[model samples]
Target: MNFLTLPERTSGRRTYGLTSVIDLGTPIRELENILSDYSHIIDIAKLGVGSAYVTPNIKKKIEVYKEYGVKPYLGGTLFEKCYYQNKIPEYRTYLQDLGIEWVEVSNGTLDIPLDERLTAISQLKRDFHVIAEVGSKDSDKEMPISEWKEEIKVLLEAGCEYVITEGRDSGSVGIYEKNGNIKSDLVHEVMKDVDEQKIIFEAPTPKQQMYFIKEMGPNVNLGNVKLNDVLVLEAQRCGLRSETFYLGERECRLLL
Candidate 1:
């Protein structure tokens, strides 16, 4: 069972090289089946938006993720929903009761003031591992690279274990243009300015994932990856795919 030398990657509960999968509404049995085979590559399973609020057997689902060693957290949009309704205290209590260890602090949709967002990050850091999100979900609303860097810096300082660049599930906002093109210049600027290890770029599409992998190597943290694309993305990360063959350490004799 000889294997080709693939691109280097970290495994076993990694922090930097993460694949944060979005769970829209996968049934518990289906989730278990997928995790049974592919849990090794999955780092985080984010129950998208407010699905956690209405999901039946939600605790059992969280336990499934935990058993597989995948950190499960509610999406930032749910945080926004709670904040909008002025129920953040209730949200915290609910998360604690659910035994959820991770929290996402984001204000993508709501106009939560900057100071308040940072305060929330700081407060949540005491009881949970916070992953704050930067940038807006709105395609037309773009934050300048300078602002992005500053915001990322402060969020990390405020106690966020990681900061997600909002490329939304649609892959047509935040880091990506409305046409789903990566804002290459903006990406490069932020990469140069921020600590790349702490940034999770939300790359939902294959093309976007390819761009980040090419630019940031195999260890780039990516989020909003679809469930089915997990294996496909892992293949690309290891250079098993044609698009990323150049990333392999050992040259292929066929090409030579």
Candidate 2:
């Protein structure tokens, strides 16, 4: 560790300042390599969408995450797919069979109503640590802050352990614009009444990750992080990187 003083942060079982990475088709050997080296700062590992269906030895993959102290979860899209096809019950069995204890409940692209979604969380929370994702994934479906606030509160109340603001895999949609900039005003308005600790902002891009660290402090929950960038993001959180050097006690002045 560096000798310079950085912002105070919590380690292990993070509630507010947490990092969740997306395992989008990570091969088993590569997955082993990344988790072995970079799992210290990671809190959760999401098997993105149906990638788990095609990926070999998913049971083994989940075991890898557990061995590294990182909880594994199936993406909400998989849940949506199952529920849409009248197989939510089967989906539960599948996850249980694999011994996964974390599950994401989201309605990003589904036609399911808000009430049903909340009910699902209420029930799912009984068996797994629920990570509910709120917000539309449609790039054109812009939601007002008022709706975001109400929906987040309702989901949390329904027993979700955490709520993720959808940024999609591309970092374009929900909480972020197509150009990958955060909708800061919306976030401030929501955090005004909602607890920031229960919310995870999906920031797939470095700039977006840095913005959340600056805005919500180093411990703000961030998700959808790529495997290779785990340490880079951690460095930013501790002001070890140039973008957030101002966060440290040491003076950092940019020169032209």
* Top-scoring candidate (lDDT): 1
Q: Can you tell me which runs of candidate 1 are displaced by over 4 Å?
A: 250-256
Clashes of each: 0, 1
- Clash pairs of candidate 2? 17-219
lDDT values for all models: 0.90, 0.87
TM-score of each: 0.96, 0.95
Cα deviation at 190, candidate 2, in Å, is: 1.1
Q: Candidate 1 on 99-193: residue-level lDDT in tens? A: 89999999789867779998888788899999999999878786989988888888888878999999889999998989999999998888886
Residue-level error in angstroms, candidate 2, position 122? 1.7
